[model samples]
Target: MRLALVTGASRGIGRATALKLAQQGYRVAVNYRKRAQEAQQVVAAIREQGGDAFAVQADIADEAQVMALFQRLDEEDKPLGVLVNNAGILFTQCRVEDLSAERLQRVFATNVTGAFLCCREAVKRMATQHGGLGGAIINVSSAASRLGAPGEYVDYAASKGAMDALTKGLSLEVAAQGIRVNSVRPGFIYTEMHADGGEPGRVDRVAAMAGAIPMGRGGEAEEIAEAIVWLASEAASYVTGTFIDAAGGR
Candidate 1:
């Protein structure tokens, strides 16, 4: 069976993606940093639905833990066929000039460095010609990367911008080797991260602002998960290095 490794699968888009991939017939390795209970719940839900899934705990920012995650997958005879680098942290809204060094580093550690490390390990095992099997990597970025997030969260935007660049460069570098890299930039999805950011009502606010868009609403986690599932599937065999914007016209 094909295996999918999804970081930050405890909740929100990551959880939704894990469930979606399982539904698509991929045995899922659900990765979570701290919310062990929530992670286990995701696993339970998948099994209840008659899907194959297992929860693996790891802080994606730590290289050793990320390496061990893959090692465990190897031991299970479930070499990764798809990787969703969805584990990320968002800082409280702060202006660029007022950002703290600690806060900045923390964001980068989880949002940027974590994705890099996971992608590195995944590529090591996913290179078409060298690795046993060719696979796909889907980075969950944000539309804020393009919007710049202005007075709200420039640091978060910058980190996702870095992810966007990585997706493009890695896609070109590994396409010939049968590994496709792409990003799903969701615009204003309601997730736990927003609550952590001190604005649990942000999604409602965004929905009001979304009046300018044709769709007239914020995107849903399941909608974004659907796009991610498609990008990781064979249906997107010819697609790579592209950003699928799931923003409702944002």
Candidate 2:
């Protein structure tokens, strides 16, 4: 069975992507940092649907943890066929000038460094000629990178911008090895990250702020999941170093 390793698989886009990949016949390794129970629930749901899945915990920001996570996957006898670098954290709401060095480091640690660590490991395993078919790395980015996310969370936007750069550069470097690298930049999706920001109603606030979007509403996690699954599948064999925007016409 093809195996997929998805970080932050406990909720939102990450959880939705895990379930979607399982539905597409990929045995999924659901990676979570602290939400063990929620991760298990995702695994259980996939298993109940007759799909192969298991939960693995790791903080993607830590190099040792990321290495160990991949080592564990190797031990499972499932060389990774796909990787989704979805684990990330947003900084507390504050202006750019008010952003502390600590907050900046925390966001980049998970958003940029974490994705790079996982991508590096995935590339090592997938680029090998003996590791079944070559794999793909899909980084989950944000449209805020372009929107500039002023006033609210520019730090988060900058972190995702780094992810975009990683997507482009890494794709070119690894294209010859049959490992495709790409990114999916989603606009204002309803997720728990915003809930933790204390405004569980962020989607509505976003819609109010960006009123010009043609789609007229925020996106759903399932919507982004479908895009992610397609990019990882053979349907996008010719696509690499591309950014699939899941924004509702923003």
At residue 56, give the lDDT of candidate 2.
95
Report how far residue 107 has shifted in candidate 1, in Å.
0.5
Question: For every candidate structure, what is the RMSD over all alpha carbons to the true structure, in angstroms?
Answer: 1.1, 1.3
Residue 200 displacement in candidate 2 (angstroms): 1.1
Q: What is the lDDT of every predicted structure here?
A: 0.91, 0.91
* 96: Cα error in model 1, Å: 1.3
Error of 1 at 20 (Å): 0.6
Model 2 Cα shift for residue 179 (angstroms): 0.6
lDDT of 1 at 169: 93
Could you give candidate 2's per-residue lDDT for residues 1-250 as a string of tens digits?
A: 7799999999999999999999999999999999999999999999999899999999988999999999989887766899999998985678998989999998999999999989888888888564546888999999988888888889999999999999999999989888999999999898988977667898887687746566878889999999999999999999999998889887
Model 1 poorest 10 in a row by lDDT: 209-218
